[model samples]
Target: MIDKIKRIVEPVVQDFNAELVGVTLKGAKRNYILIVFVDRIGGVTIEDCTKISRQLSKEQELDDLLGNNYRLEVSSPGMDRPLKTPQDFKRNVGRFLEIEFEDKAGLHKLK
Candidate 1:
């Protein structure tokens, strides 16, 4: 169900020239919390968050997708942009990154 929601929501964001970096669901007690992360060229503003949140809330409610009670948060990916997939690494090849790698020893840079 969550994956379906992500799929439906991601493209909608992409249509607005924003990249859907990730989606997270936290807090199990109250159904769940949905956080959608989008990235636009010049960074996101509070208005962007409000607009996406409003639209997503309506869609989730109309489809009854998030159960009866849940919090839906839509905003730009934070300073810690989620590294959700291998593609994230490839896409950010030249960008500065900080990560804890398992079975890794020293710091290395990708050219």
Candidate 2:
């Protein structure tokens, strides 16, 4: 579901010269919330979010990708955002991080 949404919205975000950071779907069946996080080299602005939201809304409406009752939200990934990709890690270089592995190797904390 998320991958599909990403494929649909990423181009729109890129058109604005921003990176599509992540997408999340939340809430109940009929009240699903679609959250899109975007970022850029100089960071994102409210105007940028609004533009992306409007464009994405139009695209979604045309495609009916999310069904009828979903609310779309576009915004920046906040300070405590999860690091999901190598690019995310690279962007946050020199920052502190706590990493955990599932191979029984205990938690690894880094700075």
Candidate 3:
């Protein structure tokens, strides 16, 4: 589901010279929430989010992707962003980090 949404949104984001960091789908059928996390080299502004939301919303509606009522949210990854990929880790090098592993090894802090 998310992959499909990413495929639909990534190109549009790139067109604006931004990165589509992540996409999350949550909530029940009629109350579905689609959260899109976007970022760029410097940072993402409210205007950037609004523009992406408006364009992506129209595209999604036209394609009938959701086919139901869903709230779409577009925003930037905050300070405590997740390092989901190696690129993210590399980008944050030299910055303090607090990480938690899935194996429950306990939280680890790195700098």
Candidate 4:
């Protein structure tokens, strides 16, 4: 479902020179919410979010893919969000970060 949505929205996002970081769908069957996280070399702004949201909202492909029951949100993955992918790491090449994780096997437990 997410992949299908990405296919529709990714190009629109890129049209504005932004990266489609991630997409998430949440809530019940008939009441779904779609959130699109976007970023770029200089970061994201409210205008960027608004433009993407408006453009995506106007897409017939989105309506065809998701129907009219879902809500679409476009925004940036802010500072508190964790960097979980190589691409994410690449974007923050020189920025300092606070890392947190759990050892799945408990082999190197910190506490």
**Highest lDDT model number:** 4
Model 3 regions lying over 4 Å from their true place: 61-63, 89-111
Residue pairs with backbone atoms closer than 3 Å in model 3 (clashes): none
Best by TM-score: 4
lDDT string for model 2 (1-111, tens) is 778888898999999999999899998667789999998756789999999999988884424766777888999997677788887877667766666555568666554
Q: How much does candidate 4 score in TM-score? A: 0.80
Task: Give a tens-digit lDDT track for model 1, residues 1-111.
Answer: 668878878767766667787788887755788888876656667887777777776675425766768887888666666577775665566667776544467665442
- What tens digits encode model 3's per-residue C-alpha lDDT throughout 1-111? 778888898998998889988899888667788899988766789999999998987885424777667888999888788777876765556766776555478665553
TM-score of 2: 0.73
> If scored against the real structure, what TM-score would every candidate get?
0.65, 0.73, 0.75, 0.80
lDDT of 3: 0.81
lDDT of 1 at 7: 82
Ordered list by TM-score, greatest first: 4, 3, 2, 1
Q: Identify the superior model by lDDT, candidate 3 or candidate 4.
A: 4
By summed lDDT, which 10 consecutive residues of candidate 3 come out lowest? 60-69
- Candidate 4: tens digits of C-alpha lDDT, residues 1-111: 888988998999999999999899888666889999999866889999999999999999878777778899999998878778887887777776776565766544222
Q: Write down the TM-score for model 1.
A: 0.65
Model 4 residue 56 lDDT? 92
